[model samples]
Target: MASKIAEAELDSVEKVFAAQEAVPSWKDQLTFRSFVIGFLLTILITFIKVKVSLNTEIIPSLNVCAGLLGYFCLKVWTQCSSQLPFTRQENSVIQTCVVAGSGIAFSGN
Candidate 1:
């Protein structure tokens, strides 16, 4: 019985060793490259949202929600696949920009 188990283990190890595969994690996942790209995209969208809010005279409630939603998305990104370290400063910046932008947009509307 012991020999049988040992043989099975050896077979499994050999099979696994024979397999050629890329790294377990995605090559671009959570790299500084991806983080920077996401950050820039967020900035641009925030800018557009504020512009629209101003043009349409949106309400404060919607502005607040929009900002919160942006942070929520960031949270998801960080939790699921982000290799980037989460920081208080980063979160604070995101929250501030999002809230301020949303406010400006909703107020305009």
Candidate 2:
């Protein structure tokens, strides 16, 4: 019945939430590795933005680029090491730095 299905879905959702809460979250500390990677990514993205700006009037999407780069880096890191990979907060921090750096580069042009 539709009611049974709804109840089942609700139970499943509750179970998932319980499981998530039981798992300890990663420490919120900013590691040196994250800082260095974010800085380097910002520089690299800014350089690419400037180069593209020089060649064409169309501006590149730094937000998307930053997100993709962050995701890729985290994925690679997760694969290469047994340690916990960067979290969403870390990715957001990296993207913010990239956007700010790229904005400066654009303004200087």
Candidate 3:
């Protein structure tokens, strides 16, 4: 049964590839989008760190944790937007953390 399912999936994949190949000059390049997204993320992280650092009311541990959380958030956003190539499972891992952390961070704010 598994083998049959796998075969069916392979057939669909073959059709998809064939269709893609038939397209004329689709660029298929993500370099510019990737650069822009990365730049935006860097700016955001820097801004957040600078702003948060001004108020030392937050514990040092908390700041570190938040910074790490921001990093993960950036990664998740980039991946979800197809910034970098990843398998479905890899994307899911980052996406799950992104959503949970975003919820916590926003509510805390």
Candidate 4:
């Protein structure tokens, strides 16, 4: 089973490298749509976190929330439109922006 997993990992890496060679490098993955969506989500989550903090002693997990939200959004987008210009790295950047914006929001509070 371990060997099988290792083989699968190697195959995946090979495929990634092959795909990388075929695809042109994207100069900018930070689209306005992704930025706006990420910013809005961060604001919404931060607001929820603040509200929860104020209403109860338990603190919400922002990291988990941000990760899950980003994953779900990316998954949905990928499923709905395979032709969309969004790439995996772009999704990553979006998530990072979301987390950073959330941190800024928290600092302000």
Which is the better candidate, 1 or 4, if ranked by TM-score?
4
- Output the better candidate (2/3) by TM-score: 2
TM-score of each: 0.35, 0.68, 0.32, 0.71
Steric overlap count per candidate = 7, 0, 0, 0
lDDT tens digits, residue span 1-109, model 4: 9999999999998887775555435666666656766887888888887898889966676776776677677767667877565566666767788778877887688
Candidates' C-alpha lDDT: 0.55, 0.75, 0.47, 0.74
lDDT (10s digit) by residue, model 1, range 31-71: 45334534554556556766665788662244444445545
**1-109 in candidate 2: lDDT tens per residue?**
9999999999998886774444344556355556666778888988888888778967787798887887788778778988876666677767777788778877887
RMSD of 1: 13.8
Error of 4 at 44 (Å): 1.0
lDDT winner, 2 or 4: 2
Best by TM-score: 4
Q: How close is candidate 3 to the true structure, as a TM-score?
A: 0.32
Query: Ten-residue segment with the worst summed lDDT in candidate 3?
Result: 86-95
Model 3 segments beyond 4 Å from truth? 22-30, 45-109
- Model 2 TM-score, 2 decimals: 0.68
Q: Give the higher-lDDT candidate: 2 or 3.
A: 2
For candidate 4, the 10 contiguous residues with the lowest summed lDDT are 19-28
